[model samples]
Target: MNMPVLTSLRRRFAALAVLIASLPGAADAQADPAATFTALRAVDQRMATIAYRLTTANAPLCRGLVPVPGWAVHSLGQYDPAMRDQARTSFGFEAPIAVEAVVAGAPAARAGVVANDSILAVNGQPLRGAPGAKADSNARDAAQAVIARQPAAAALRVELVRGGARRTVAIAAPAGCPGSFEVLLGPGMDASADGSIVQIAVRFFERYTDDQVAVVVAHELAHNILRHRARLDAAKVSRGLLAEVGRNGRLFRQTETEADLLGMHLLRNAGYDPQLAVAFWRDHGGDVDGGLFRSRTHPSSKARAQAIADEIARIPAGSPRPYLPPLLATRDTPLQ
Candidate 1:
C-alpha cells in the first residue's frame, strides 16, 4: 500500500482562509458572498485538475506519494467571522466540513462525491470541530488526517449529507505525487512551491491559457520533486539580500536551471508539449523578469527560453513514459 503524505495534505487544506479571501470579487465578499464563493470554487477546480494530471502522471518519479481523492474539502469555520453567515447561506454548510471541489474524471468524481456535500464521517469516525470556532482549520485538518491514513488504492468510505439525506460512498484513492495545488487570491503574477504545496497567483489564470499556466506549474513541481528547498538549506545557502551575489547566487541559479530542465520533462510526461516551457518564457518572461525572475538569481527570459529549447532537443523522440532526465540523477546529491 502506498503511504499518504499527511503533512502535505494537512497544509493544503489548512490554507482555505487565504484561498477564499484572495480570489477576485473577494474584496466585496460580504456584499455578494455567492459570487465570491463561486469564484473561489472555480479557481480551485482548475488548479486541482492541472495538479492531478501532473502529479498522477509523474508519480513514479517522485519519492513522496499520497493517495489523491481528486476532491478538496473546506470548513465554514475557516472563513472570517464576519463572513460565516454568508458562507453558510451560500455553501449550505450544515456541518463544519464540506466538499469544496472535485476534479473532472478524478477518483472522487467517479465515486460520486459532488461539490458542497457535507462530510459527516470517514471510516466510521465522525468529524468533530470546536463550537463557535471561527477562521480555524482544526476540524478540516482532522478530516483530512483520517483520509490520508488510508492505504493508497484502497476503498475509503466517506459519509456525506446532501439535501438532508445521508449516504456513503467508497473512493478508491490513487497514488500521486504528494503536494496540494492552490491558486492564491491576488493580482501578482507569480508561482511558488513550499515543498508541500504549489501556489500560483490568480493573475496567471486570468491572463494565460491553461497550457501556458501548466508550464509554470511543472516548473514549481520540479522544485518540489528535486527537493531544492531542503538541498539549499543543507548547503547553507543564504536567502537574504546576499542571495543574489557570489556563491549564493551561483547555487540559486543552479537550482533554477535544474528546475527548468526537469520541469520540461514533467510537462512531457503529463502529455503537455515541453516546448510550451519555451513559449511561456518567450511570451511572458519580460512581465516577470523585473519581479521574481531577477537576473541575479534567474537566467534572462531569452536565455531561459533557449535553455528549455536545448533540453527539449536532448530528449530522444518516442522514448518512453516518465522520461527520466539527467538532472534527476543529481536530486539526492548535494548542491554545489
Candidate 2:
C-alpha cells in the first residue's frame, strides 16, 4: 500500500489535479467471438461482485449518511454486436441497464434482484434522464438519479426481467455510506479516493484477478474511510519540493500505513481474503521504481509486506467486524 515515491515526485512538477496514482495483454487468433466477449463479461462480473461486497460490508460504518444501492449495472449499448449477442444468449434479455452483480445481503439482493436482470424502471419511472452525454454515464446516471432522489430509508420499486419474465421488486435502501464506486476508462492498475468516491481504472479490471483487484480497491476505499486526503489538507502539508523532502512525505506514509491496516479489515469484512494483501504486495512491490529502502515517504516493499502479514496475524478468527471511520475532523471540499 506504500506507493512509490517516484510517482509522487513526478506529480510535484504539475498541478495535483488528481490525488493519488499507485503502480500496480494478448488477442486470440480466429477464436469464437463469443469467447472473447465472455472474457470481458467475466471482468465486469468481478467488478460488480467486489463493488457490492465492499459497499455493503462497509455500509454500517457509513450509516446515517445516504448510501447507494449495493449493486452495479451497465448499458447494453456499451457492448458491441457480438458481445450484445453473447449477453442475450447468456442472460435472456439485454436492454436498458443490465444487472451485472448484486451484493449478498444488500437491499437489492434482499429484494431478489439477481445478476442478468434487465432493469426496466425505477419506481415505475422509465430509465431516463441520463446526466452525461457518454453512453456509460447515461446508463449509470439514470439509475443513480433515481436512487439519489429517494428519501432517507425509502424503498425502491424496481421492475426488471429475469428468465424472460417481468417482475417488480421492492428494495429498502440502507442508511449507509455516502460515496459510490466507479470504473474509469484508461490504462494502468491505478485507483484513487477523493473523500467522496472510489475510482478504479478499467486497466485494473483487465490486469488483476478479482481477489487481487479487491486488495487494491480495499486500499483506496480505506483512504476514503480514513479521510486521508481531507486530513492532509487540514494539516496544510506542503505540496512542493518541501513536501517531497519530508513534510508531506511523513504525512503520506502515515496515512498509507493506516490505509493498509484498515484496508485488510475492509477486505475481510467484505468476505475477501485479507492475506491477499501480503501476497499482492510481495508479488508486485519490486516492480515499482524509486522509493527509499528506508524511505520517509513509504516503507520499502519488504517492510510493507511484513507489516501487512503481521496485521493479518493479529486479526482474530471469526466473522470480520466493520471498522467505522470517525466523522470528519474538519470538512473540506473533496479534491478530484
Candidate 3:
C-alpha cells in the first residue's frame, strides 16, 4: 500500500494517540450479519477493479477518494483465546477412553458428561475420531458439509463405552466466549485501551501450559506494536471511499499477513521461541471458525503460524533473549 504524504503529517500527532486500543463490537442492529457480511465482502473483493477503473477513467475528479469505515469500521474478528473454552463435543465413545478432562460451563457438563465417559458419537458421528484431524480430508469435508446442515442447537446423540458397557446420552453445543480461558473458571490474556495494557490471566497455566500460553500473550502483545487497530481504521477509510465512489482499487488484503509478519518479529524480539507459535496453533486452532484477513479479523491460523516460523528464521534461532525492563541506572555499583 502507498503511504500517503498526509499520513506522514499525521504521524507526529498520532504518535501519542497511537498506543491505545479497544475491543471491537459486532454488526449494527439494522444490519443482518449474514447479509451485511455478504455485501461488505463483495466490495472488498472488487476493490482493486473499482479503484483502477476510477483512476484510469478519471483521476483528478475523484481526489478525496479515500473514506475509511466512516462512522464505523471492521476487520477479521478473531475469536481465539476467548472461544477455546466454550467449544462443545457430543456423543459417547464406543470404547473405554482416556478422557482429556472437560470444558467448564459447557453442555457436556450440564448433560452429565463426566470425564472418562468415553463418548461414542454425536447424533451418530462417533467421538473416537469425529470432526477433527483424526478424520481424513474426505471425512473432514463430508463431516463439515453434513454438520453445517444441522441447526446450531441440534440434539447431539452421544454413545459412550464406560466400564466396559455401552451407554447413550444427548447433548447440545452452546455459544462461545471471546477468549478460551473464560470457560475454564479462570481469566486469560486481554488487550484493550487500544493496545496500552496487555493483561494476562496466567494463574492456572496448567491447562494451556508452556508455549501455548506464551504464544497467546505474544500474539496479543504483537497487536500493540503493530498498531493494528489504527492501521485497520486508516485502511478502512481509504477503501470505503473507493467503494462508495464505485471504483476498484488494489484492496488491502495483505494487512492481516503483514500484521502476522511484523507481529512475529516483535514477539521473537521480545524473546519468545517463534517455533512454539506453531505448536500453540496446532493445540487449539485446527477447526477455527473465525475470520482471516479482510474476510475476517486475524490471519488464518496457518498463515499466522507460518509467519512466526518465517520471522524466527530471519534471526539466530537460539540468540540471547531480549529483556523488556527499562534500562537501569549506570551509577548503580556492583561488588568488585
Candidate 4:
C-alpha cells in the first residue's frame, strides 16, 4: 500500500494496542488499593520510558543495512563496563575462544551473527582448549574450522532456542575459505546481499564479566539463532517503534524481540545467571528518544527486563557455574 493507507493502518493498530494491553488500569496494579491509581500512573510513565529504550537497544543488533538512527554510527564492543569484566572467566570454558570475522554474502550473515556472537562451544565442545592470550580467540578459530570443514555453498544448519522455541535455519555459504569470513563490531558491521552473513565491529562478550558478558554475548548470538537478519530481509520495510515512520520499523521490532528471547536461552545454556540479562539492560542506560505515546521497535526496556526474568524462572537450573569465586571462602572476605 501507499503512504496514506499505511499511515491509517498504523493509527488503527495504535488504538487497538492500547485496548489490547488494557493499559488504562495498569496503574491499579499497585501495592495497595488506596495507592492503586497513583502506582498505575507511575507504571504508565515507566512503560513509556521502556518503549524508547527498546528501540535504542536494537540499533547495532538489528540488520546493519537498516538506516534507523543509531545509538551511534558504530556500536563498538569494548570491555568498558564492569559487567563485561565480570562475565569473563565466568563461563568456565576449558578451552580458548576463537573469534572470526563474518564473510559478506556468506552463511553466517544469513544466520544473524553479529561481530560479537561468542562461540563459547563448538559442536558442544567448550573453547578452553583453543589457546591464545585471552584463550577466547580459540573459540573464533574453532568456529572458522567448523565453517571451513562444512561443504562449500552447502546449506549449513545452526541450532538456537528463542523465547520458548528452538529455531534452526540453513544458510548456503561461499565454499573454500571459511577464513574469508570478515566481521566488524560497530558501524563497521555490514550485511550480505541475501542478508545471511554480517560483519560486526565489536566483541562485547570478550570483555568478560561473568553474567554481564553472558548477557551481551547471548543477545548478539540470539540475532543469528533467531534468523533475524533473514527476517529483516523478508520485511521490505519497517519504521522504528512508530514502524509507522519507516517501512522496516515493525520488522526491526519483531527481530529484536525474537533475538531477545533467543539470547535469553543462549545465556541460560551457557551456565550464566540468566537474571543478569535483565540487570545488564537495566544498567545499559538505553536511549529514550520517543516522547509520550511514542513506541520503539523492540519491547520496552522494562519489558525486556521482565521478559528475561520470566525466561530465567522457567529454565531448569543447568550445569554449575564454572568460574565463580569461592562463595564460602569469599563471602565475608574484605574487598581487596
Per-residue lDDT of 95 in model 1: 79
**Which number leads on lDDT?**
1
lDDT by candidate, in order shown = 0.77, 0.62, 0.34, 0.36
**Model 3 stretches astray by more than 4 angstroms:** 1-193, 199-207, 237-255, 286-295, 316-336
Tens-digit per-residue lDDT, 1-336, candidate 3:
222111111111122112111101212412433332232222222221221221222211111222111011110111122221211121122232222234344455566665546544546764232332121223322332333344443555566566678777666643210111111112223222133223333221324544455454444434444454455455554443452232122223344444345434444544455566666654454333133322233345676677656655666545443422121121122211
Rank the candidate models, highest TM-score first.
1, 2, 4, 3
lDDT of 4 by residue, 113-189 (tens): 42223434333433333232221233333444554455443465544333234445454533220111112222111
C-alpha TM-scores of all predictions = 0.87, 0.67, 0.31, 0.36
By TM-score, the better pick of 3 and 4 is 4
| Alpha carbon deviation, residue 267, candidate 4 (Å) | 0.8
Best by TM-score: 1
RMSD of each: 4.9, 7.7, 23.2, 22.5
